[model samples]
Target: MDDILKLVEEYIKEKDSKKTWVAGEDWVQYAGPYFTHEEYVRAVKTLLNGWLVLGAEANKFETKFPPLLGKELGLFVNSGSSANLLMLLALTSKRGRNLPKGTKVITPVAGFPTTINPIFQIGFEPVFVDIELDTLNLDLDAVEKACQEHPDAKVITFAHVLGNPPNMDRLMEIVKKYDLILLEDCCDALGSTYDGKKLGSFGEMASCSFYPAHHITTGEGGFVAVKDEQTERIVRSFREWGRGCYCIGKQNLLEKGSCGTRFNCWIPSLPDHVFDHKYVYEEIGYNMKPIELQASLGLVQMEKLEEIGLKRRENYRSLFKAFSKYPEFFHLHTAQPKSDPDWFAFPVTIKDGAPFKRSDICQFFESKMIQTRPYFAGNIMLQPAYEGLHDKDEVISKFPIAHKVTTDTFFLGTSPVINKEKTDYIEYILDCFVAAIRI
Candidate 1:
């Protein structure tokens, strides 16, 4: 086994080193995973161990990943979407905050569907609001306005746009003033920080992704982060089939149990309505746990978190500089003050009256073998699935910035893959577009 593992490690190094970029031949993806030989080795070792469920590897990951976000505990789930649902659902748990049904969750109009979908799924009332054009984050001014208009709103949920959070100082002030719960979606802002604290730390509950396109990759995984153990257990209950049992990893499989009182939640003779902890249903939840294999892969990915964040920021600056050269044609992303963003992708909005259309520049990028993505699910109200979701006919017109984003905003690769070579290539592409528009 040792000899075979050594061979595997050497092969991974050889294969990984061979990857390279070509000016017009390789498609530079907007985001992707960066894995090393350590990841490969750990994955293989875990596979060999044959304990394939969420056990030791998952346990290690929960402990290791959250501290960077200033959290002491977390619950691993199948995806970032599930992480959102887990945390939001956990808020209703008797053991947790125990907020009432129909709690109002204020969110940005422009964001991925999963963030909003969970609100409806959990029967929470969603109040959609606009985002800042420059930051593509929820407009806190609009949020304060929403709070004034809908004073009953109890929670605020929104993504840190492309890993750049809105002004945290102002956001916290709004949270405090309105007495609202912050359910932040840190899916894009894994290593980002506001006021020297991680993006996920300020919120009551936060969700993070581990998709290949995210800062880390576990094939398909995410986690719900929390500041306290009780919230952790509440979220854990939702993730683990809503069981009351809090046992993690090998503890579940222990012969007498970690508590040394196996199956003691119930006594059959006593009519006291007792039941085994594992069989006790707590919350109405779906199965959303990720496997041990995914956790093993994530463990290795966290080792490169700091370095990955540095490269992403460097790439974002280069991209921002390149686009800033065409200020008349673009509205480049402006990050929040006192915040450090390890940008997921550098988003840009085509100026409303720019000479060239978004399609024009998108075509140029495609020709150069550069990949681009539309800002995620902009104006989700316009989507077919949510046709009847909103009752107000004026809802679509209320958030003009989100509508503009749907038509005008796009993003380019800011992953570590966008090195000096990619930056130069992108500048050349932009220059060609500018020249064409001038002609």
Candidate 2:
């Protein structure tokens, strides 16, 4: 093991540590895999211990993730999507403040599918609201309208889209006024702040993804942060095979029948501690726990979060500066007032009269090997997934602003891995695109 570790260390050191910028690279990805030799070693160590499941490492991540979001009670899950699933599941648990079936959840029509998928999967109706063009986040007015239209709305699940927080202060006020449970999807907005408060901390429950593209990478891990103790308990129960027992790990199983009396049992008239932990199910739950190896990687990645934030900020600023020069060609997105965005990607919109279509520009960038992505499922309501789900025939008409964004908006990579050379190359491509279309 020691010899293998040494070889791994040597290999990492021997590799060219300098960052590279290849021209015409297939759309500079939204994020790249980042890790140090130590991170790999920690993962290897966890494997060597023969403890691959959720354990101490998972516990550590769960404990620490909350502070990053300015909250308490972090529960690690298999992926960000799973974290969303668990968050919704917790709300549905009977032990929790059960949101009755068909209860409506107000969400943006422009968000990632997973954010709204759980609401449907949990048998709840989603009240789709439009997003503001400037922030690419939920339009507060539209949200209020949606709530007023649907008084039965039980929750508001909003995402800090692309790391730019919405008007959280106002949104929180609305949530409180309507007595709605606020679930912030911070999957793309970790480290972002609104009015000096972290994005995830404002909601009743918040979720994050540790996918490679996020502020930090854990390969495939995510966490749910809860504000109240009841929510926390429900989240744990949902994650832990719906087991009612809150005890940590294998110790809970051993201490069951070890009381003073030999035949003593915790449950009335039952065998002395013979209850099967695996069979002990309470709330409807799924196995969404993340492995220790992913947690170990998370620990290392967490340490470098501040540095990553800086790089992302710098890259975003550089791209903005480059794109801002041609407002006629593109409509640049802005953060909400008092928002300190840890930009996940630099978003832009092709002007309605611009000589080029979104597809043309995207193809141009692709040909240059620079990657581009549409603003997550542009106007998600337009997708076939929600076609039959909603009552409205023209969902975009309901959310006119979001529809505008869907038609004109797209995003460019501002990931930490993108350096000056890549940014310049991207700028050159954009300039060429504009010239070609103008002619």
RMSD of each: 1.9, 2.6
Q: Each candidate: what lDDT?
A: 0.86, 0.82
For all predicted structures, in order, the TM-scores are 0.96, 0.93
Tens digit per residue, CA lDDT, model 2, 192-266: 998888888888788999988888888888899988777887888788777655555454456452222322343
Worst-scoring 10-residue span by lDDT in model 1? 262-271
Cα displacement (angstroms), candidate 1, residue 203, comes to: 0.9
Each model's backbone clash number: 0, 7
Instruction: Indicate which candidate wins on TM-score.
Output: 1
Question: Candidate 1 — which pairs collide?
Answer: none
Query: Between which residue pairs do clashes occur in model 2?
Result: 24-368, 24-369, 25-369, 27-369, 27-370, 27-371, 28-371
Poorly placed runs, candidate 1 (over 4 Å): 259-261, 265-274, 391-393
How many clashes (backbone atoms < 3 Å, residues ≥3 apart in a chain or on different chains) does model 1 have?
0
Candidate 1: residue 169 Cα off by (Å): 1.1
